[model samples]
Target: MKKKTVKQSLAVLMVSFMAMTPFQQTAHGKSTVEINADAAILVEADTGKIVYSEHEDKALGIASMTKMMTEYLVLEAIEKGKITWDQTYKVSDKVYQLANAPGLSNVPLRADEEYTVRELYDAMVIKSGNGAAIALSEVVAGSEGEFVKMMNAKAKELGFEHYQFVNSSGLSNYDMLGMYPEGTDVNDENVVSAEDMATLAYYLIHDYPEVLETSSLTSKVFRPGTSEELVMKNTNGLLKGKSYHYKGADGLKTGTTPFAGSTFTGTAKRNGIRYITVILDAKDKYGQPSSAERFIQARELLNYGFDEFKTVTYDLDSIEKKKKHTLPVPNGKEQEVTIKVDKPLSIRLTDEEKDKVKTTLNLDEEKVNEDGSLQAPIEKGEKIGELVIDTNEKEEYIFDRKSSDYKVDVYAAESVKKASWIVRSARGIQDFFVNLF
Candidate 1:
């Protein structure tokens, strides 16, 4: 004879319809910050969600901002125990030549001088020193060529499709020392989209948070206690006391070249919320200084992210806490087992969307047996269903077509084992006697 089974119908909860309201202008209306950048983006640091973007995928030269990759590699080396902050590295003749070269931002280094890895890192980050970048690259990878390979490999590993690095620093092939064979017309400049840059910044900060301690420095000495105490000032203008000083602006890198125009990757914290902004190929226009415009654009983007969006956190634990839904177990020692959500969810939304946000839970019935009852011997962590949450927000942008829907797997909270016929009979008799009392 076939064993008996139970079947359950799908449950649907109709959340509020207010979530379907069309997007409307806020009290301040749309942002008036004229983003003069060829490509720019603002992202929440924690969630890595794009808050505001304009031409974010446009490819452009990143200039000195390329050093961010170099910084990442050095930090990685430190983390892997290949190098240490207190360890020292000697300056090579090539590094010396580049440092003394005319018109390049650099902290002067001498062939006879040995500097700590920490000091050189400070120079590279604080001053955008091409020489310091090369010195650190050589120390980490034995040669700048090898370092560039590692950089590209890392970019690929990080899911970058359109970024290329020709040098550890963001210098052009011709400008870099031996970047290309003599007299080659190869345009070997670092190229990346604003989106990729933002992604890179996100990982760099996420993995090595200590980098912010260095990037946020407004000014420092490159060779303190030495005769050649070169003063290194932060290239990012949004730092405190700068011309475009923003209130909460902290660390990040800046870049500019004739070909790349001006670029900046800035991060700031306000009221415990952090934002990262990227501006590439920002040009001087409308009576604004060319180099200064990137900072202004970055400031505006960061501010927009903070002001326009608020975080919404959903506690999945509450689902199990408030009410425990049990699944009927067929031919088991226990008649039912509880279920729970696998993980929590969070999202950022504008005030308008937040006020209208709605969620609904739906269980997938296809997993049910023919009789709608789960089989006994069910594992504690088995995925029995999924919870579907619909915020009712729609993306009208040409780039994104999917609705604001999130799904998380629901799992069995406890195990259930099959019971023998004798055990079931004894349990039924015991229950009858207890109820008679």
Candidate 2:
């Protein structure tokens, strides 16, 4: 009986060890890093394809990384002519108080001191200054509270359905999800999910590259009036030196909190390849040096994408570029007449598969109305038929395997007589009504 018990214990230990070994290989061979964080994600910025992910959709406190949205809004303000770099804002008492408040990052601007929007932005991003964040929020939205509403609204606008906001500065003392009583409906600031961070990062880079320039700065001088001449250093150590040896790793935000752990939205560009990596709640047992872990993961993801996946440009120049035609009906008068694409066009494919993919025309009979006959004369480039590609493969991948059939719209060459004017007008009205809903 004792031997049986010992054998069972040994078996359990072996199973556990076996389970851990694969994860170890994943960490080592794949160059993936595991942190104490709640979630992390790595994506190829060019393709928008996720390369690595773990609990990516799980929401958690985003900490100061909320400033990414802050940066976006500020840029929007600038673009709308509501503000400019040269515009100077008087330092308010609220801004002064927040600046001097204990435990908050600040440049400690005097109430009388003024800074340009550009300077304030530099302070906000370079120092991760809570006071700077609040001041910018107020200057943009009249108050931190109003600015937070903008933040939440922007999250919704960006399709970040998994997020909510309660403060301009992510300094709330409660879980963003309100899991505790301290996490009241208001006053409890929060955000969650590394996927949202990745989404935000993508927009900031693709939609607003100007904001990316600020995060890449390692240090900056805020004001020259001070005795020491206010110098600020970037909180994101990954941007510090060439020692990390990551090319195009520049411009992003980082965050940390007791409840949130560590969070970051980092972007790197190499050659034409760009990638964004978001890590949330990253920490070690001793609670230091997690940045290196994230860097390793990001480097690995970028290398894998660039090395493993080759971008193939299917030379469409060889295929006869056909012309599209318009039908000569009422509104369908010969706008254009075009031939079908007889080949599957692709950007990424091996030499062999690229040769065999052939395009075929699919001209299905027009859909009949209540009378069981075709609708009125078709217009040029109208959706009359389709072009299908045949790859000769049983299974098809969207990009390389086979191109899905596309509708062919060859317009009628003849125009309707004047007697059909009333019918065409009725059809136009019907179309307008149908689209109104």
Candidate 3:
């Protein structure tokens, strides 16, 4: 069974678009997206903002897209110095048989086939080659089962809360359930949600960008002397032609199974900005090009995000002008503090609307003594209170506590006496003498 290409299906209607502005910049940006998959999402690779989404939280069978996790784990191993690119891996009979086993997408390998770490990596990522994935997994761990344990461990370390892995190749056979005992079947395939997939894609590209080197290739060939060179072509059709014109459309991975449907995880970089889009269970409607529906939806969302919205940085100065005046403090005070506004508030709105963006300073209500300082020293970086922002009849939200670097010092008792006190005593004595007269 070979993985089939997802053809574009019915055109989906675009609705309820929200335009998010660059933080503290202008408010005219907009987001428009169209998608037909059971679940679709476009996220800012850096901010993890859902530029657009439909059924974004739904968990679905992602099919071979599970390979994305496999790739991530492999890259992580290389990064941690557990393995190297030039490392040699000997093919085992189990992995070799599984790699060559019937699958929709595979780079069949025979026993005794030896490949460098880099060559096998290319086959797995570039060719969507299941054989390559299993072979590499076996080499990294003593066996595929152990390699899968590593995969699950890596997923947990990466904070993937909504996913579980059962195999390295992601070939879960529902039809062949009777082949194994009821309790120990290989049918436990990897599963993930749309949000989880986006998160996975984000970490993969952000942390280990080198993985794309293989996923983005149009084709690849691996040769070890004495063995005929093996040739495999990339299954991702987007790289083969100039259809979307999306800049930086590099490699990621694609997956499909009868039960899981068509899935793709792709990364694109445009104008120094990068994004990862995942479409799970992509189905073809009538008259649509292969994967066209998904491609179109992904492109529109990425474009809207890149074109209309720009990242505007709101520095501490923006917060200072809003009102909280600093009381005099000891020297060496660090007045600087940063507040991260989750979303850009509209600055151009009506005064009433602007006023709605309220703030509450949670300063200590402790009184300052006559010594010109508070009775107790306020600890630096301590949360005295909070600054709350309320906008347009919405909930009153508390801003995070901001701290100053300097501590307050109290005036010494001796410093308040002597000449300064004598002058005060003389004035009191004069008033008393006048009253006696």
Using lDDT as the measure, the top candidate is 1
Clashes of 3: 14
lDDT of each: 0.74, 0.61, 0.57
Model 3, 52-141: lDDT tens per residue? Answer: 555555556676777787788788789889889899888776656556656446666668867788878887787677767777776677
The predicted structure with the larger lDDT, 1 or 2, is 1
**Counted clashes in each candidate structure:** 5, 26, 14
* Candidate 1 runs further than 4 Å off: 1-33, 174-187, 270-272, 284-289, 316-338, 355-383, 392-405, 409-437
Per-residue lDDT, model 3, residue 210, is: 77
lDDT for each residue of candidate 1 in 1-437, tens digit (9 for 90 to 100): 00112211111111112212222222224445557666777777876666666655555778899999999999999999999988888988888888878888888888868988998899999999888898998889888878888998998787664566778778777775554423233555677777778878988889999999989889997677879887888978999989999988887888888766678999998887888899876655542226888888788777777777776665444344455578788567888888877666666677677666555545556657766677778888988876665656643221223544767777889889889989878888988999999
* Global Cα lDDT for candidate 3: 0.57
Q: Candidate 3: TM-score?
A: 0.65
Query: Which has the higher lDDT value, candidate number 1 or candidate number 3?
Result: 1
Each candidate structure's TM-score, on Cα atoms with residue i matched to residue i, is 0.77, 0.65, 0.65
Candidate 2, which ten residues in sequence have the lowest lDDT sum?
A: 1-10
Q: What lDDT score is found at residue 280 in candidate 3?
A: 66
* Tens-digit per-residue lDDT, 1-437, candidate 2: 00111111212211111111112123212444443445666666754545566656556778788888889899989989988989888887767777777776667777878878888889888888877777888789987767878987887677664566666667653422222212135445467567778877877787888776788888888777866378898877567573454667786887776655566778877767677888776555554536555455455555655555455432222333535322222333332233233343433223443566665443445533333223444433344454444434332110121233322332334332232566668778998999998
What is the overall TM-score of model 1 with all chains considered together? 0.77
